[model samples]
Target chain A: MRNLIDILDLTTSEIDELVAVANDIIESPQKYAHKCAGKKLATLFFEPSTRTRLSFEAAMYELGGNVLGFSEAQSSSSAKGESVADTVKVVGYYADIIAMRHPKEGAPLVASMNAGIPVINAGDGGHNHPTQTLTDLLTINREKGRFDNLTVGFCGDLKFGRTVHSLIGALSRYKNVKFVLISPKELTLPEYIIKEVIEKNNIEFVETTNLEEVMGQLDILYMTRVQRERFFNEQDYIRLKDSYILTPEKLENAKEDMCILHPLPRVNEIAVAVDNDKRAKYFEQAKNGKYIRMALILKLLEVE
Target chain B: MTISPIENGIVLDHITAGKGMELYKALGLAELDCLVAVINNAYSIKMPGGRKDIIKIDAEIELNLDIIGYFDPGITVNVIKNGVNTKLPKIDPPKEIKNLIKCKNPRCITSVEQELPHIFKLTDSENKVYRCIYCESKAK
Candidate 1:
């Protein structure tokens, strides 16, 4: 069975296929509505989530599939110290697929290893959130129309933004994609990603703390929240919380078509006024998440 | 000082100088009941520094060659039976290792799930980079 623990788990062709399926679902929602009518999706969330859990439920519901599982660890058997493997193994019997989210990294992978059913990693700590990457990919594709030859600027906390890392890893596979990393030095992109994903791929990239300096050059401005949960110390979190804020003034120099994207629950990183901007696509991104997830479910379940 | 040759055992030769104790500790040779001799800074014509370390085991015990290969593939292994030496093929770094090293990342699933085996996959063989399969954290 196919499981998506990381964005790299899907090849470029597979990703294209998913995007195509997602677009088709968007075009004619009723055509694929009954595709997974008899299937059940088990959303085993061991951590708190708002959009992701709801998106998975909405996706499954739209596909005519039944949704069953907990929204948090306390609501599930995990609160009683049940292992991810055991929980998924038991759930596999009842559900045809699983969507898991956990605070600990690789919990879904552990689930996938034991789960007889296909598993999708909804989110896992700050390590990976491949579905979010897919959402961003769909947003970019719909807004910009192509993944190649775009100057993508990743602003704010690149260090703890699993979405940014996953998106960068995904985009590096494309041709002529230049990355403009804008973040404070303390919250810069991890060295391993720069060395392994960007440098190894020979992708052009420039790192800077100033967002405005490179704002005009970007075709896609991917803003990320400086997550307070990812910090070990309150002082560090407070110090970096307001590092980058996307506002109307910041968009002055940006291209008219520069698509702004964010994985929601954004905190104060994105200004409320920017939401009115035509270039703002974060809401659309969230909507796209449901459709892509529907496509992913259909693909994993091998439904016609 | 001359050490008595083992009648039937294994000889680990050409270990990088100063890594004999590390290899011994890694292999848990200190816990072994059989006689084990570690010769440090032994003159070697093949080694770059003209010095190497050699380990002689007095009993036929199973050795994890992957650990040895991860340490240094240049190190040679020899099986001695009835005072005759039989050199084995050169060791290669293992594609995957389990329970050898713990994932140091605090957020890694293995850290909380004590029952989960600490597994690492060789992601970059050229750099000998082994990363935890769970969190992709580099094995230090």
Candidate 2:
């Protein structure tokens, strides 16, 4: 009956439990192969998101559950003018769970409210992507082996990056964690987030425009792309698109074990050469997306 | 000018000056068939400016105290019966407001779903911060 519309919906203890389950699934994939053999998952994607949609499908398939529903609004009843509530309510009749992504923020919340089955917000516009935050958390836990006392640096478009906001909100819950927000003045982290999440939690943080200068101090470098879709003006998007390119030269000043992470769909913000560095874990982060999703599916479905 | 007292109605006293019309609109008092008097800039020693607004409803209609409290908590509610004060209602900022104001965030689901009621939940009571339930956009 529970739904994940926001990252804050999951408590730190529950997150720890999910991470534990994810690690267990990684260690023993076959043990969970048929856990959901008789279940069905409906992915009602009102917007196109290949990676997230594929991850959810793969997670369900790996758990022996059937995947149904459309990949885009045009392919679904939504193209015919069906409301999200009616669509999900009808889908709930066939599916035991729903994972929805919509271009409009809070669309999954609407689905969750109306649907009889549990709903997972795969991605909701620029508002919230709890699963991505979960993926990032699993990656952080695996990389640093702990969530406490790590100095995390968020570089690039902090303003529109929901992942950065969600991750910062998630990480702020742990003790002794400090944040280094590195972004252009125009795209700095939103003031509301800084006030509500950072300052409210009494977490230490420093804002900087220079990523390289603070590179060595970070235990985790979370880089985000300046999304063209989030901007209204094409000229502004073009001006900020290449704001930070994580070249290997920049890694020279970073810690030997400093983890480099990006919520994929990168557009030149991260240089291709840096992918070879041992610090690069964005690909691994993508793989972790599936495992954590599998763990989330199991949890929400109440499967052992 | 003298405003007559209602026999069986509610009186909202000591509203911040100039907020009478806003409270009247928010409370939908214009739609009421009964007499509703809005007296603005009335002299008041308690108010910081020594002036206040008073609303007198000449009917025994249910009032949404939360809305009134949100508009001005200092305002006192007096229930009169037979032209004598019978009861006093307490007020506080509402925990959740529905359909009172529309969510201005264009990305909010409520924007596209015409049937969805615009809902805001009080996230920070001390700061008087109300955020849209759907998109978490702070209310202005």
Give a tens-digit lDDT track for model 2, residues B41-105. Answer: 99999998999999999999998887876676678999988888964756778999888888999
Candidate 1 structure quality by residue, lDDT tens digits, B1-140: 99988999999999999999999999999999999999999999999799999999999999999889888888899999999999999999999998888999999999889999999999988899999999999999
* Best candidate, DockQ: 1
Per-residue lDDT tens digits for candidate 1, residues A1-304, read 7999999999999999999999999999999888899889999888889999999999999999899998889999878898888989999999999999999999989999999999999999989999999999998998888999899999988888889999999999999999999987778899989999999999999999888889899999999876667677899877766658888998899999999999888778999999999999999999999999999999999886
| Residue B55 of model 1, lDDT score | 97
Off by over 4 Å in 2: A227-243, B86-89
**All candidates: DockQ:** 0.92, 0.90
TM-score of chain B of each: 0.93, 0.93
Ten-residue stretch with the least lDDT total in model 2 chain A: A236-245
Query: Model 2, range A1-304, lDDT digits (tens) per residue?
Result: 7888898999999999999999999999999999999899999888999889999999999999999988889999888878899999999999999999999888999999999999999999989999999999999999999999899999998998899999999999999999999987778999999999999999999999888899999999999876667677898877766657889888899999999999998878899999899999999999999999999999999898
Candidate 1, superposed: residue stretches over 4 Å from native: A227-243, B30-33, B45-51
